[model samples]
Target: MSDKITSIVGARPRGHGEAVARILSLAAAPTFAIMALIAAAAPADMLCAAMQGPLSLQGMVPMYALMSAFHLAPWLRLVR
Candidate 1:
């Protein structure tokens, strides 16, 4: 398709989250490294305790579990 046609049709475009995901992908390694360092340096107990006061267990656990599955799916196998 030509650019003129696309422009005339008002091409559907990336959403805000998609754009943010692109930016995040560009910096994921450094971001992960910094996060890892922070986690490593923080006291183990404090890491778990830190989020309790502000975060709800009902939402946090399931969200992290789902995200963990998404991130780990490539390396995981399901026999069933």
Candidate 2:
């Protein structure tokens, strides 16, 4: 005697969250380093302009925070 079986598929595998976390965490350091280098190499006037420009300090903090969050959130998950 033989038995028949069927398989069903739905959403594709999104991959392990830990994998995403690891990649993001590893990427964060390099990304920050590059950004820091760029900032350091920029002319004083450019840095001042960026600080005083339309975004202003107030806008800059949130933007940076959001970017940092995107970068760190995965790593935080991995740590947990």
Candidate 3:
């Protein structure tokens, strides 16, 4: 999940490295079962605590849930 986001952020589609970067990112997506477990955990407090947030964990949890869904969907070949 993290791998995919970071790769997309760092990759340049205009570059020759595009294929390599995309392939690597897709390869790192977690399996659907594991993804479900992770989403259920919804570890937003830990994340906020770790980051020492100037931001609200309350607001972020929903977004984190959405990102978890985003990350999981790719592995099901449902979305990219």
Reference-based TM-score, model 1:
0.30
Candidate 2 structure lDDT = 0.50
Superpose all Cα atoms of candidate 2 onto the true structure and report the RMSD in Å to 1 decimal. Answer: 11.3
In TM-score terms, candidate 2 sits at 0.38
The models' CA-based lDDT, in order, is: 0.45, 0.50, 0.53
Q: How well is each residue in 1-80 modelled by candidate 3, as lDDT tens digits?
A: 55665465454356446656555545554443355456446665675567654444445444555555666543555254
Q: Better model by TM-score, 1 or 3?
A: 1
In terms of TM-score, which candidate is strongest? 2
Off by over 4 Å in 3: 1-19, 27-58, 78-80
Sorted by lDDT, highest first, which candidate order results? Answer: 3, 2, 1
| Candidate 1 local lDDT, residue 34 | 54
Candidate 1 global Cα RMSD? 11.1
Candidate 3: worst-modelled 10 consecutive residues by lDDT: 27-36
RMSD of each: 11.1, 11.3, 10.7
